[model samples]
Target: MRDVTIIGGGFSGTALAAHLLEQLPGGARLRLLNAGAPLARGLAYGTQSPLHLLNVPAARMAWHPERPTDFVDWLRAQGRPAAEKSFVPRSWYGEYLGARLQEAVRRRPDVAWEHQVARITRLAPHAGGWTLFDAQGARAESQDVVLALGHFAPADPHPDLAALASPRYVRDPWEPDACAGLDRDAPVAIIGAGLTMLDLLVSLDHAGHRGPVLCLSRRGIAPLPHRDNELQPPAYDTPDDWLSGSDVRAWVRALRDAARQLQAPQDWRDLWVAMRARTPALWQRLPLPERRRFLRHLQVYWDVHRHRAAPSAMATVQRLQAEGRLRLQAGRLQGVQDAGAELALQWKPRGQDALQTLAVRRIFNCTGPSSRLSQDRSGLFPALAADGRLLPCPLGLGLLTDADYHLLDAQGRPQRGLRYVGPLLRAQHWEATAVPELRQHALHLARALARGHAPAD
Candidate 1:
């Protein structure tokens, strides 16, 4: 039996595997199953576009916290030295992760490590562990299973929009050749205004598409850009007393008050960073009603500020906007229809009484990952839910997991020997998506598994 079977090979899975290999006992066998993106370069970092850059600076992106400069050190050794504060292309980061995984494997030849490209569709409880089945009828038994399944593609925002399924309507912008075959000068519509939309803008520019690109979302607020010198961490006064409350409005008021007192406008970014360490606790403190209120009202604003883009990428967006090649608008997309030779998008502009139509040659859903598990088309999650092996969060954010990241079952019992670590932990920890937070999760989970705390029945 496999000592540990990891169900995804994205960053979270790869990082956990590397850590486990370093800590697991000799003679232990580990298996990594990926649905076919490269082992380390998952959807986020697998882009081939050189213009797609890491939002975080190089100094802070290392997978292992103990070796904070591991990424930078690797870059230097590759003869491609980058400043500690520079935002490097994401592909390079993917290469770095691949190298790290290989190093971990090479360093521990005593442990058996195997990676297979398989799409896991279901998991069955067997002999106190799990019997995992892939799409090909193959099966594997493990003493412990870790679900590091990364982000799923965005769900169709509107029911009507889903019905108009044509090649012109791109469901996932990350898919290869997503923008292929588009006329160079034809207008395009993107269904989001967040970091993913910004990435699409960069991609469009890289592809030499000079057509006007319209980005539409409910709020139409784009992500803020990072400061050029992000290396110097700013000072922000922490309001510990104010943060103890469970009221969302009170928390927002405190944040706004603190923002007003920032030494400089850029210091607001630092203020957000200062609040990062406390977000998960604050989120947990709130009653479910208050959490729902925050999601309904404040999530967009919080996302724009918390998840800022690289200055270079934002600069490209601004340049395109200034050139009349890009446009950002606040609106709700109502529906889509076939317009002769083009697709017509019907949307209601923010604060407008009347709907308007925009015809574009192509429309891409640049909206980020789907948060609702009910909309998950992947057979894996639905199967898990049906078997009472997994429980979806009450808020519909992600799966429910305990403090140690053990997945909770339908009856709210923590499933021993079964765990998860990824953005889905957002169900419990509001700020669990990024690399910094995920790396920590990976490390903690790895340490627990290595300690043999989760024994097979």
Candidate 2:
């Protein structure tokens, strides 16, 4: 039996794998499986688009939190700046994660790393551990399993989007040349005007496409700018009931006050850093209703403040908008149809009654990934849930897990050898999906799993 089986090779999985190599007893075996666009980088950081840059900046993008200078040092070793807030390409960070994993693997060759390119269908408890099976008829037995399923696929678009899901439609932005060789002046339609759309504009620009591009969304809200590379220290002491089922607003107020107390040298980023340190507590406190309220009312705002655009990306977007070639339409996508060589899109401009249609050569779904884990395309989680071996978390965000990342049984009990990481943890920890948070979870779970783990719920 394998010592460990990591389901996804993305940042979370790889990070955990790294820690496991360090903490696991000698001769421990491991296999990393991922059906998505390879491991370590996953989808978000796997982008080949140079326009997509790391939002956190080079100084803070290290996979190791305790080793604050890890990424910066690596960058400098590779001839890049170590201490600067450099806006490197997303793919570069992906390469860093890949390299980091390889280095760890080299240190522990007994931990066999397998980049399984097949979808895992089910995992069942067997003997003392578990047996995992992929839809492609592959099987492996492992003492422990880590489901690092990163982000979800994009949510299915409005029914009208079906009209545009053609050769002319780019459902995903990462596919090979989704915009390759298109007519330079061909107008493009982009769904959702958030960070994804902003990045799309840069991609189109780099592709030499100067045609008009229209952005559509219910709320045409854009992200707030990061004024400068300033740090803001936490304003208040850690709350007494930080994670004790209290009001989130009260918590935010407490945080804001704490922010004001931060003196010189520390800028707004310092508050972010402080919040990052104590987020698990904040998330554990808010009960279900408060969590849902945050999702429905504050998710977008929170995302903007948390995941920002690189300075260069923001500049390009502003330049495009000023040129009028970039249009922001606040309305629902009505429909799309063939407009001869191009496509015809119909929508009602916000605050207006009449419907309108525009002809374009392409439409890209830049709505980001679908967030509901219960609605995921993967069969593994559902199979576990169906078998009563795992319960879908209360919010349907992931397979329920205990504090140690052990998958919870259907009775809301813990199951050994089964753990999860990545976006799925959003249900339990509001801030768990991001890189920094995921890295910490990976480290903690690695240590727990190494100790002949038991449920910590």
Candidate 3:
């Protein structure tokens, strides 16, 4: 059995592996399983689109927490000039991660970086560890398993879109040419109005597709841009006070009101930063019904405000809209009909009774990954969930994780050996999406593995 079996090779898993190889006992081995696209890059940063820039600036996008400039230094050495406060492309970040992996592998010859190159269908608990079975009848065991299973394919809103179930439709936005073959003049429909939509807008523009693009969702609220980030205040020095009650609606309203009253000459974004600081304590205290309220009412606003896109990306979208090449509307897409070479979207505007149709040559699902581990379509999560090795969060942000990234079992107890180190901590941490937050979790998990401590801390 290996010392660590990282379920995903994305940033969270790979970062933790790198940290463990350096901090943990040197003799221990690391085995990584990457069913995702590229090894080092996770879903967000895995795209090859040079137009898709990171939401966060370069100053804070380092791989190591202790060494914040580690990535910048590496980039400078490789001739990627440091443009202060600029949001670099996702591909550049991927390169940095890939380089870091190479360095880690070179330094530790015994550590195994096996690109499983196959799907992990099931995970079972053995005597003192776990066994991961590949789709090809291969099984591997490890003392610890980390579910850094980054972003799964987007959740389909039109479950009965049998027309979209064909090869003509693209579910995964990161896949190349997911929007292929549409004439520049032909109309197109996008499922969600988030960063993914912005990415598609840029991609289509670059591809000379000046066609009419339609973006639709429940709220149609787009991600806000980051402006004057330096003025934003920290979420909270002691944010645990917010998570004590089962009344989620009241809590969210109180927070939103508090954010609205910010008169300290702060960036509007700081309100979100403050809210994020206390999310772990707050989410843990929320009861199931309260969490449901959060999902139903607060999820859309939180997503748009928190997960803002790069300014350049937003500008491109705005430019297109001004030129009448794009249309953003809040609607409920009822179904999709096959139109031979194109798909017709049946939708109704938000709060309107009348139905409408938008015929487009293509459609892409960017509805974000499902927050529930139990509902995860990936073969790995369900297997672990069934075995009681992993559990879902009450708020359904992701798999249940403790402070140190331990996956919880069916009985609400932290699984002793296995641990996580990515945005997987979303169930516990609010600011866990960006690299700055992820690096901290990764570093801590590595220390726990090295010290051989239980995951509850």
Candidate 4:
């Protein structure tokens, strides 16, 4: 029997397991190693709040690409709202993923589907396969291993304040009661204006928090909201025209010119969809220098536009802004200091040299995922790097991988029998994060493994 082990039981990992099992031989074994993260939920869908919604619509979130309407159909079968364009709660989606995985295991009783809850910290090549070692020295061997370790927690952006041992400071918002425990009457400073900040704002509002909220980020830009209007793909220039140059600035100009041609800004969303469809090719075609420049200078703006908020979530944020309860600022955090009854957040505005300060009762970091491997706290990634089994991709966004999703070694050669299917592939493919892109990768990788035909590197 071919034995396969998947690390991290998050969305990607769980989905990969289901798809792989469906295609594998009847007696193959599959092991799922989950490190504290809820099976099938992962970081994105683990939120308990019903206020948190999927960025994509219900019809587009199928775990398998071939079954495009599987999620929506499941929702309908359960008598939940199954509108094609509706944004559903993430918790519900998690349940759907879990149910799907259970169904897969149930159908293939002959295949040993072992689920283990442990943190694997070390990996070693053994007997033409691989061995995984957990914290307690427990070991498991498999013929193939897939690194589906989802998103990494954002490192403390302002490391100076990381040493503070006060309950008033929260470095990670995903922790239970992170924002809920804040003093309801006192203001709170959230260190990012992206999706995570929106989530915290919604959570605080639901908890009846009436205090002023400060949403701070380097760019002070918030994601645009999806509208109820139907989505129609936009027709931009021919591939020859858009792909003519590798200059980042030229590409941005072309995109802007295309959007300007349309009368309304909302129409730009169509162009965004088209751009996302082409990101893989566009990203690979650019030289490394141009890719780095895009990340350094244009990533924030691109993100705010590319990844939009659900209509309902955006409306709530807008309502909060109109009520004068939320303030968005552009600045870099300098440091934090103790004050008489609160903490003083020292920061510098976008263009000013002088340091400005804000006093708040509590602070939370919502700066989103950290892509740098050096910042990974888990001992697993560092071990891989030390063993020459992993290499950092360009722009430090994620690990280096070939087009076939095979993890590259220190010498830039694909490591056979070692695969990766997660957001970290963003380093090689700009559109690797969202469900639509990820599901395709999962299906392709699984089919390849089952057929014993590794994709060409």
- Best prediction by lDDT: 1
How does candidate 4 fare on TM-score? 0.95
Candidate 4 residue lDDT tens string, 1-457: 7788899888899899999768888778899988887899998999988889988888788899899889999999888966888888999999999999999999998788999899999999877788889989988888899989877887887876687765578888888778655777798899998998888888888889999988889989998987775334445444556645789899888888877776654478877877777898889899988898988899999999888888888888899999999988898999988886888989888999999888898888899978788776778888999999988875777898776777899999998778888989888888989898998888888888887733335
Model 1, range 1-457, lDDT digits (tens) per residue? 3399998888999999999999998889899999888889887999978878999999999999888889999999999999999999999999999999999999999889999999999988887688889898898889899999877879887776676665688888888788788888989999999998988888888888999888999998999998999874866667558566799898788888877877764578887888888888988898999999998999999999999999999999899989988889999998888876988889999999799998899899988988677765658988899889888988888998988888999999999888999998998898999999999999999999988833455
Tens-digit lDDT track of model 2 for 343-416: 88898887888999999888888888765656567876668768988777566566568888877888988877
lDDT of each: 0.88, 0.76, 0.75, 0.85
RMSD of each: 2.0, 3.6, 3.4, 2.5
Candidate 2 off by > 4 Å? 110-115, 163-165, 230-245, 248-274, 350-353, 394-396, 453-457
**For each candidate, how many residue pairs have backbone atoms clashing (under 3 Å)?**
0, 15, 2, 0
Total clashing pairs in model 4? 0
| Decreasing TM-score order of the candidates | 1, 4, 3, 2
Pairs that collide, model 4 = none
lDDT of 2: 0.76
lDDT of 3 by residue, 303-351 (tens): 8888877888888988998999888899899888887777878999999
Candidate 1 TM-score, C-alpha based: 0.96
Candidate 3 residue pairs that clash:
235-274, 243-282
Candidate maximizing TM-score: 1
Of candidate 4, the 10-residue stretch with the lowest lDDT total is 229-238
lDDT winner between 3 and 4, please give it.
Answer: 4
